[model samples]
Target chain A: MDDAPNSEHFTLSPIGHMVSDYPDKFGIPRQPGLAPAANAKLVLAAPYNDPLAVRGLEDFSHLWLSFIFHQSPQRWSPLVRPPRLGGNKKVGVFASRSTHRPNRLGLSLVRLVGIDTQQGVVLALQGCDLVSGTPVVDIKPYLPWAESQPDAKAGFAPQTPSLLAVSFHPAALDTLTQRSDSATLHALIEQVLSQDPRPAYKQKELASKRLYGVRLRDVDVKFRQRQQGEATTLEVMAIEPYDER
Target chain B: MDDAPNSEHFTLSPIGHMVSDYPDKFGIPRQPGLAPAANAKLVLAAPYNDPLAVRGLEDFSHLWLSFIFHQSPQRWSPLVRPPRLGGNKKVGVFASRSTHRPNRLGLSLVRLVGIDTQQGVVLALQGCDLVSGTPVVDIKPYLPWAESQPDAKAGFAPQTPSLLAVSFHPAALDTLTQRSDSATLHALIEQVLSQDPRPAYKQKELASKRLYGVRLRDVDVKFRQRQQGEATTLEVMAIEPYDER
Candidate 1:
């Protein structure tokens, strides 16, 4: 139509950056709250660090963070196969919350635990799905009454993704005990490995016998997949301090 | 930290534009589902309009629309006074759902009524707050389990904004009777006026006695404010077709 409004382009700058436990995308939960013990913080930058800016933020229990899918491929396709859909059956990119979107923007609902103004404004967030050092473009308080629709159908992913049973060998348990934050570290590893972050296509296949390793925080978790009845299970074989070299 | 990742810049092209009754920003509902009667259609652009791109989208009752605030000022403040807080208290732009932000990007959850693919894709959305012809950069089906938080506390405007009692004068009733879509027009007028879309500063002043008008759809609604004790009421005095001149 002649009255149609033209779309205007704008440049966006990061107001903050996230410091998360998951160094790479390999072991990060697909969504927030899935990893309750996952610790992260949004460190504000420049003018955004003013303490007065977040005066009333503590009252809200949850917040929505809009961040870029920094590691996703730049090219986007209209249709994508969602891992939740067993990586089969193509669905529209708009239908699935795939990161390969027109704009690689991601929206995640994270629990707001506390705000630390001692060293600038760092929002202590729990259950974050972002990888370490992800740039955050925007944040907004999650209004429950207006946002929640518990009964609304979720289409493909209707229920919470089933979790895998995780077990650690004696050697792995001993390594975990050596850490100063042993209790917290153990819980974090169990919570993360329970999701079975293996590729969707590999979920049903029998054990490949390959020792798969994923870097979480400052440690490298080595695990192997084992067939458990109708489901697959993960066994932690080793936990070694991450070697940057 | 030396390991901190650098923020990368991205350029996004709009996939669609909305056509709605709200021509300007003045009386638009601050959030979606606030104005259920406010009808809008997101007409998809080329490439994005492929029928396959919308497959299985209808199964989801709601969708998340990522749009730009085309009319907002280019510059943003770290803190802003939200009208819900009586426009007195300042909250971080991130803590409040303010339009003026680094990206000018807004995420709104809208009820997806239907999808028409006969001539390109046209999604019928209800309870959307987007202005007419607003550019839509991305659309994703709202996953209830992931997005909803029924019990989370909402700061400032915790509950829905209160509605005011609206009455139509005899003259206004007469004007409505002459309209072809009288029933729909009457409902639209009632739905909009009930919100009491006045400036926060002007809402409490008793009996301003001034005739206020707002444009909804193709009509200019003329009404007056009357204070009834603690509650404010609106009386529709006349309804005139919007004057394009």
Candidate 2:
């Protein structure tokens, strides 16, 4: 093996950052493609914003984004408790896609809805789970022949995430009617609530009257989950403009 | 929306390097899983070599490897000529999966064969395209539910690689009969040659009698391509131990 010097470390400067719908880590979905309506805009920085840098990128329908988990803790552990495993069982950090690892690298596959160059190079993306201001390191077009693996075994996480039923209150429905792009934001709220975005312990509590606030776009969505015997449903109480207090 | 400071720069150090069958960059497949017989061993460096760090990873059948193109030049271009496109027409660097880009990051999907830690943390991988001593920055298990996309539209690279016919010379066949793992090596040589591992311009030459050499393992594999009428065939001339001078 070739043991040469200067190969030990590598530096990656952000080519761009995402202005996604996700405001914080509290309500963001764990993985992409679950919420297809959660769209984001990727804005390229400084010299990289040259239109020539993404000349033929429009031809690609999907792309792979290599990004940094900027919000994860700097200290890492050898083992991690995956939320999918009920956040109890321990598995090697590599076995689970945990952000707190030796490296804070994150990989995601996003559908390219459209590419715009009005002000700078801005890309409209769908099915993204990254938060706003997430630093993107590299972007590559997805090769179907080389990457598609439908029959692969998924060890622990076998099934797709189960969805919960969601309903809107009279006040929340009124808020949607007054908005111009209410149809888009309405779908985003329904999809985000369907994933049951709550801690394992909170999800297990029977009929706990905890009103959770999820920030979607510029509104603070206040909702609560109710359990009637074996069935559970999330109902939105109100939707108001977020106040940074 | 977020103008956070210290979020633009990221640093990644090598967790380990691969000791693969490919000795140099001359004959390695452009994409992984091209040559199933081609195997490699990834030896983890200290601190990352802890056995607990890889626990439960055996359950997953495949993994994603994030590596650096250390052998490539530090300079990059916005446009690239892909060999898949006959190396004539140029495409934006982002449209193609060329190693030369804004960042030197390379992503590959490989099947995890086995993991051994008798001496250190050595992982046996199948269907890799990386050369020996290739530095790896991160490893993550493949999530079938989140990452699988068989219906994706590939803009340029739409089809799987087409392979050519490969034959062994009398001396080359004789050399295989004397080796212990000839079956494995024989299949690797045939699969490698089937891809027509020659420059696009060289493949168009009028049956030029130029002999080519590819180093596989510790041997120098001498081969040539023969053209007749409209059919082309590659033949192995000899398999001899390579000498470094």
lDDT of 2 at A80: 90
Steric clash pairs (candidate 1): none
Q: Model 1 over residues A1-245: C-alpha lDDT tens digits?
A: 34433344556667788988888889887778888887899998776778876778898999989888888998888789988888888998888788998778788899999999997799999989998878788888888878888888778888788888998989999998888978877888888889888888877678577788888888999999877666677899999987662
DockQ of each: 0.63, 0.65
lDDT of 2 by residue, A111-229 (tens): 99998887778989999989888888888888878888777788888768888999999999999999997998899999999888888668878778999988887788999987889
What is candidate 2's CA lDDT for residue A83? 78
- CA displacement after TM-score superposition, residue B115 of candidate 2 (Å): 2.1
lDDT of residue A6 for candidate 2: 35
Number of clashing residue pairs, candidate 2:
0
Tens-place lDDT digits, model 1, residues B1-245:
34433345566677888998787787777778887878899998876788778888988998889888878987888789888888777888878888987678898999999999999999999988888878888888887777788888887878888888999999999999998888877887788888877888887679699888888888888999977777778999999986672
TM-score of every prediction relative to native: 0.95, 0.95
Q: Which portions of model 1 miss their true places by more than 4 Å? A: A1-7, B1-8, B243-245
